[model samples]
Target: MAPQSNRVVELRIPSELGYEKIAREAVATVAHRLNFTKEKVEDIKTAISEACTNAIRYGSGSDARMKVVVILTADEDKLDILIKDPGASGAPPIDIDIPDIDGMVEGKRRLGGMGLYIIRELVDEAGFVEAADDDEGNQFRMVIYRVEDTKTESSPEASASGADNGGSP
Candidate 1:
């Protein structure tokens, strides 16, 4: 369970502020080093941003301040990110299931629910956790895994799951 390398960075996101850029920079820093392609890196950033954006929405109200925590970690052959957010009402639990794309139409649909769908598609591995909030509110945990090769994934510990996707692999 030891990472080859890891970095934990925390930032305060105002309800009126956007946290996507924070996610992009943090993921890019370690992903580039882990040999993730430019496109793959972008996908990973998108996933991370989606989750953070939701945390800002559901966790904290516009006037309240929230926290964005990002951890960049890797082994010799893989990369994993652990991002945690404490919600506005404190951490509301996150549902891992992808949102229905059909019902969430652009013209008549919701704008905010696409993050969970996109996050699953972009990452090789994804996991979410809702924690008990004392003063911080709800907490959500997102883990994205990036392994170097398909061969390595055949082992007992495969991080990526295809349950919520649309045959992307």
Candidate 2:
């Protein structure tokens, strides 16, 4: 496929626990076809899984009747993913905190809530897209570049930790 051309794949899965696996496998195939490295493909898979899980569980409340829509836009340079849910859980989080594993183990914090953080770390860009006036639910977006750009490299630590990493990827 031409580098400038785009291929789009859309999937609508039931709002249930195991359905996210479908999206995972579909994204993996697309990433491989786009010539993404093995490591990057793995990252994309995990990120999509987490995003879809969040959509099914929190976004649609696992209603089963509701459907979670996943849109995969494959380009030569990057793969863009958009997941839409019915927003049964209201607004998505404004911030993604570094997972407090220690606190969770110590019984000071909740065990889950790490999905968004993990997605942010794995992909080049990840966040909930602002919905339009007529839109009803949440639209989460994630983008993974096939090739890393060293010039614009930015570490996730700057967002997770207040300190900067001197532009390390």
Tens digits of lDDT, candidate 2, 59-105: 99999999999999988778889999999988777767677899999
* Prediction 2 global C-alpha lDDT: 0.81
Report, for all candidates in order, the number of backbone clashes: 8, 0
Name model 2 segments beyond 4 Å from true.
1-4, 150-154, 157-169
Report residue 162 deviation for candidate 2 (angstroms).
14
Most TM-score-accurate candidate = 2
lDDT of 1 by residue, 50-122 (tens): 7666656665554445465656555565566655555445434434444555666755656456566566656
Candidates in order have lDDT scores of: 0.55, 0.81
Clashing residue pairs in candidate 2 (N, C-alpha, C atoms within 3 angstroms): none
The 10-residue segment with the lowest total lDDT in model 1: 160-169
TM-score of each: 0.66, 0.88
